[model samples]
Target: MSFRLTTRGLTIAAIFLTVVVVGIGVALAATSTPQFCGTCKSHVPYIDEYKKSAHRDVNCEQCHSKPGPFFFLTAKLEALQQPIAQITGDYEKPILGYVLNQSCRRCHNNDLLFHPVSKNGIRVQHRHLIEAGFLCMRCHSTQAHGDAVPPGSRTYPSMDQCLICHNNQFKDPQGQVATSRCDLCHTKPNYGAVPLTHKQNDWATRHGAVGILSTCSACHVKKGACSDCHKGILMPHPAAWISEHGVIVGKRGGNKACDQCHDTKEYCKTCHQVKMPHPAGFVDSHPAVTAQKGSDTCFNCHVVANCQACHDLHAAGDPRAHKLLGGANSSLQSTPTPISSPIAGGG
Candidate 1:
């Protein structure tokens, strides 16, 4: 029970233990390099992307690893499992697993964390979002590189970050939205190419249905900006529009607003399948108009069958059928004239 190793034996044991400790230290140091991360085929792309990123000069571990020994070891151990998962085809793509807000705050910590100020008295503060448990990635996903980063391309910011608060659909507790005007954000406006979202093939026709009107108000002040090209159309139509817009459309000779936001053939035909250009009670006035204009006016929209069915005409090639305008009281006809009802197709 009193057995003990000699001093020489103890010294030999100490040297062997020291060699093992040194080997572990060297292994950890070697694997910590960015080059080591580039060794994996899946990680090579991310490493190349990071090399061209804003944080290119910064150490990968600084943002990627936790501070204290326990957490750091946990992170490293988790990282060690990634290669096995990658080989097994179980790894997530785009490399978005890490949440680096704590690492970002380590360097950006200041009074601005609590009280942020904007030059134009606009609310640029983000403390409320932080307090409500939002991560930095929510708004800053592509700060260093775009989500779909191309090789050698400069890091680009997403416009969604600005639109999140500046959009008209978004409002503060006071029910006021930030100004979405172009001059408010840009010194020199680029109005040539519109927003990328607006570049769709059908944008011109479908914008009114899907677009944010406030976004349009950002660049277009809604005065002549709209009517300059639209010429005779009135948009966001005036009050009592249902009762009054017929006159506006008539004065313009056509509905320019309709042509602006719609493909007349597809959109107009779908709704006006039962009717043409005339409104209700038009049947009463069509007699004089058609008589002055001749049968060609009715033939513009109606087929011969429509007139025949209305007039209950037995003869097919009778040009004198034009005399029967506005339902002349002719009981001599076999079938009675059917009344014309307004078409149920107006939106």
Candidate 2:
């Protein structure tokens, strides 16, 4: 059936279409509210946190959605799954969400970029940070959500987070290094105030285990601060230090420095098997000492060639030397006796 459109029929159809479009727009605006977002069980705690945040006056869609209209419409369409997931009880446990940098810049604008702001006790210059490609959410993730999330997932800015980039190694495109100095970021930093971690009884020895070593470097800026306590050794010993440490101690003349951190009397003696560097008269007394403890103890520091080199000086006429050396030529013999056996004053 072919029907021609009359003026009355066309006018009615246009009004009906306009009303439907306006109604859809009204529904979209209504559902974008925090109150509507809170209707979902997963978003209740987050909405409560948002209401108490500094951004309490800001709408949910302002930070949660991107800046432009196209992104805002896409975000709304993506949120269609929230009702379905809520009903089915299959949503993610912590319901992760992200705010784009563009959304943050929309409200913060270029004014924040060039100006330095004093917040709490921090002096923040957003110009360098934003230009360096850091996302606003990197340090301010909890600006809206607060601590509504779980422990490990909490995104509040911390000294640890600041140290990640503010460490002296990170450089800008212009080759200026990021300053790790506390005064650079902290407005009124009390350098004399000891951190609570330093108050622990065992902190002197155990602080290295608590956090990254670079975090300590942030405040203890002096080059000698670590070496002074570490006695010139690396704060955490290098991987091959065990095998090469004796040479290092030899060059330093003694283990007097090692005694600062280690209980060398008990600890070093366990490995050395004798008083290290020997007692004052060890050269003359070692024969008797070796008789008691065995030559295996001497081998910890000395080899068989060392004994041969010294014993060869004994004279054939000296009976005491002859008895100790088992004859002057005995030291020259190619087949050497075990230093532990009775052949060389051991017994």
Candidate 3:
């Protein structure tokens, strides 16, 4: 038979239960601290950066854990693997973590959303973003960690991030469009502030080489902003532009305009397969040159009328034209191989 519980036994049991509860509470509190997180060598760099960040005064859990007891407990339970992973050296490189919008709103508050907040000349309308269901971490991901991680891992907001939603095409629930006007977001934006890349002497000529046209498009939002300076030539020209550029060049009255972006002297000669402008006395030597290159190459710059102008004289039985026609025919007969059209080949 089971023995009856005595007063002494009951008192001792109650004290033991209380002690266990208090011990668990203490352990949970201790582990939630940034100090406890920093104990893992992998977290030391993040902790160091967090200490220097604007949110240094805020506890790690205040942002990392969502508000309410259930989420707090859940975050704590999820954190249990950190120590195990650290011991086994099995943690992921560039450790990833997500901060909930609820966690941010706990301190930031809904009041901040009603009005735009200015930071570093940027006017951010939180209400529009929050209503649109954007996460606080979408822009402020690096606020606590700073640049502790690699560039790809750092989620600090940039013009590109803003352009994702502020591209004028994106509309709110109320049908109000998100315009990409710099004035809407930038308070007294120094539009004249030349980028560091633009400050270089050769930037005017070499800007296309950087391959960051999206960065350029962020500010140059006009429809033909690039084409304006490019003289209607599409910036970062299309694949077909290589084959079709000859037609464009011909319409523009020679490759003189191409000198704006290209070193036409060398660049043109590479594809032209001959002197681009045709050196002095080219008219005299053109018969041999045309026969060697082909009539198609001539069509790149000259129409059939150009050849007809000289050939018509031969029809009239001019002595000089007869001599020139004989030379042209002889050269044409000698070159049996046919050359393809430079216009078609984009030569």
Candidates' TM-scores? 0.46, 0.60, 0.57
Error of 3 at 90 (Å): 1.4
lDDT of 2 by residue, 1-347 (tens): 89789999999999999999999789889989998999998888888899899899988899888888888889899887779989999877876777788888888988876698888787777787677687777777778878886555566446666675677887778788877877887887574446667888998777876766776676777888888777677766666775778888887668786776666655565336666557899888888886676655555455456775766566445445334433223232333233223222221
The count of backbone overlaps in candidate 1 is 0
TM-score preference between candidates 1 and 2, better one: 2
Candidate 1 regions with alpha-carbon error over 4 angstroms: 1-26, 66-68, 86-96, 110-135, 138-156, 167-177, 188-194, 205-347
* 2 against 3, candidate with superior lDDT: 3
- Candidates 2 and 3 compared by TM-score, better number: 2
TM-score of 2: 0.60
lDDT of 2 at 226: 88
Clashing residue pairs in candidate 1 are none
CA deviation > 4 Å runs, candidate 2: 1-9, 165-170, 189-210, 227-347
Order of models, best lDDT first? 3, 2, 1
Ranking by TM-score: 2, 3, 1
**Alpha-carbon lDDT of model 3:** 0.73
The reply for model 3, stretches above 4 Å from the true place, is 1-10, 191-347
